[model samples]
Target: MKSTPSNQPEQSVQKTFTNLINALEQNNYTNFISQGNPAFKEGLTKQIFTHVSEQLAPRLKKGYSSVFLTKLNQQGYQVYLWKLSFKDGSDDIVARLSLKDAKVAGFWLN
Candidate 1:
């Protein structure tokens, strides 16, 4: 499906989040980073990517169960939050993502 500005912000953010998850699952950090904002790309290097991948590998193994939490608009950016459940008994993952210009401007998986 083609995505346009008229699409719901939640739908757009969800699609982007799904794609990011797929890239992470496949160990395609390059593809994953390419989707981020310029500053995100600059902040994440190969070493950092490797570290993050290692840290997330275990929880990601069991995949995730997600519940939409909320949405907010801050400084012209659209932010979406999701509560993620993992099998490893870790704290629930709170995924906070900010979207700008149809791309991911920021992302946090806590």
Candidate 2:
């Protein structure tokens, strides 16, 4: 089940999200994890990063816009969700970003 919270995150989170998205688009593993927490960085190695990047390359290359959806709080972490709409007629992607202590705990796209 999805938790459709009433509010979206603040502007700061939007900036962080943009940075993360840019890193992904550039396929820079180091920059991608630059804002991540130790655990988050440890969980993703270069091989894993390459695989995911390969899978997302097509969508990432195209112009897209993201709409803030809602935020969820879990175990002292803030999890924000966004919907990405592609200009090339690809399917939308659901982006989830979790932050703990002002650092990225994890990020996923589905």
Candidate 3:
């Protein structure tokens, strides 16, 4: 879906998150980090990505499902909450996006 001006930021952030997950699943770290903000890009490395992926491997074994839970806007940042469901359990994923610039400033899978 295309985003209109009114809801462009939210839509863009959502799309970014979707694409990031797809890239990660495909082991395409370059494409994944390309969607990040400057700081995110600077801080994330291949080793870090590998470590994080390994840590989440158990929950991702059967693959997973996701649902958009909510969004909170504060201090120019839009924090999107997503619920990730695995075969064994569930967890929360947080994406702190900078809507003002349409970039992902931070992300967490817990």
Tell me the whole-model lDDT of each prediction, alpha carbons only.
Answer: 0.77, 0.89, 0.69
TM-score of decoy 3 = 0.73
* lDDT value for model 1: 0.77
Q: How many collisions between residues are there in candidate 2? A: 0
Order of models, best lDDT first: 2, 1, 3
lDDT of 2 by residue, 1-110 (tens): 88555666788899889988888788889999999999999998988887888777668787888999988899999999999999888899999999999999999999
lDDT for each residue of candidate 1 in 64-110, tens digit (9 for 90 to 100):
78777777889999888888788777888788888888878877888
Native-to-model Cα distance after best TM-score fit, residue 85 in candidate 1, in Å: 0.7
| Local error of candidate 2 at residue 109 (angstroms) | 0.4
lDDT per residue as tens, model 3, 9-108: 3566678877777766666778878878788889888888877766665666667877776677888877777767777766545434344367778777
**Poorest lDDT segment (10 consecutive residues) of candidate 1:** 3-12
Candidate 2 vs candidate 3: the lDDT winner is 2
Best by TM-score: 2
How close is every model to the real structure, measured as TM-score? 0.81, 0.88, 0.73
Model 2: runs farther than 4 Å from truth?
Answer: 1-8
